[model samples]
Target: METSDKVIHAIYNDDDVLMAAVKTVKAKRFHIEEIYTPFPVHGLDKAMGLAPTRIAIAAFMYGCVGLTVATIMMNFIMIEDWPQNIGGKPSFSYLENMPAFVPIMFELTVFFAAHLMVITFYLRSRMWPFKKAENPDPRTTDDHFLMEIPVNHGNERELHDLLSKTGAVEINVVNNTH
Candidate 1:
């Protein structure tokens, strides 16, 4: 992504005020670069007008793949490869003994859905083990919230004044060449 040459960082102390500021900024047609919060703010995405995520669809597909793998693995191990007779129950047909594989199938389905969903989230967020933090303000990691607005073409002064009116605790105009 191309980095912005200038940006404005507006700091808010409360999530409720931050959400209202987001709606106000959007109504004024200003492009919000990003927002950083110490904790997850409910309805922040809706305030920002972001589309709903598709992680649930991906999780369902992962669960289906896990079910298929478990079915094939159990059929090969218990019926085709090495048939065994335990407690007067013979592994002669997989269909006849499907009840014994239900638990394994369910467990594998849940396991794959959970693990793969986490991995998908990490990959989508560009987050991996040992990645350096990208937050601009240290206070945002604690009890503060930050809203970054890019200074598109020469709107620094206007954005600064507008954000200041929105009850920001602090406002900084940064030249983010790095």
Candidate 2:
């Protein structure tokens, strides 16, 4: 919980304005701490120049694990432990009965990929139970959008003026010592 004595919060009324402000701030070579919006804004990450996510690779690996488990379990149950005969057909070979296991494999693959991806996202975001909210302004959760910027010494006025020009509805300089 380190702190900064000079942090400015520039509040915006719309996402479009916020996006433009972000681009302007970046063009001016100012470091943006974070932005809070009530809803997801498309292309915001690209505007911020953040790297692409790798969640899809993780989901694929999880699906592979699920498929392997399903195949092994089905093979053992249908061909090894107790061989069952259906319609004068004996369950003696796993490869021959692979068609019957396709549905189970597909279901388990989807289930594992979905469940594990959700759990991974929650953990990665530090969204555990009973965690306190980190939003600085309550209004950001409802309708307002807040952009946080670190103010260097002697540049607070310039930053405020720039934010105002970028269509910020309100600006507050906060001592973020937390």
Which 10-residue window in model 1 sums to the lowest lDDT?
Answer: 1-10
C-alpha lDDT of all candidate models, in order = 0.92, 0.91
TM-score per candidate:
0.93, 0.91
Tens digits of per-residue lDDT for model 2, 1-178: 3345779999999999999999999899888888999999999888888889999999999999999989999989889998899777659899888888899999999999999999999999999999999999999999999999887766899999999999999999998744
State the lDDT of candidate 1 residue by residue for 47-149, as single tens digits: 8889999999999999999999999999999999999887777688999889889999999999999999999999999999999988999999999999998
Whole-model lDDT, model 1 = 0.92
Instruction: Quote model 2's TM-score.
Output: 0.91
* Quality of model 2 by C-alpha lDDT: 0.91
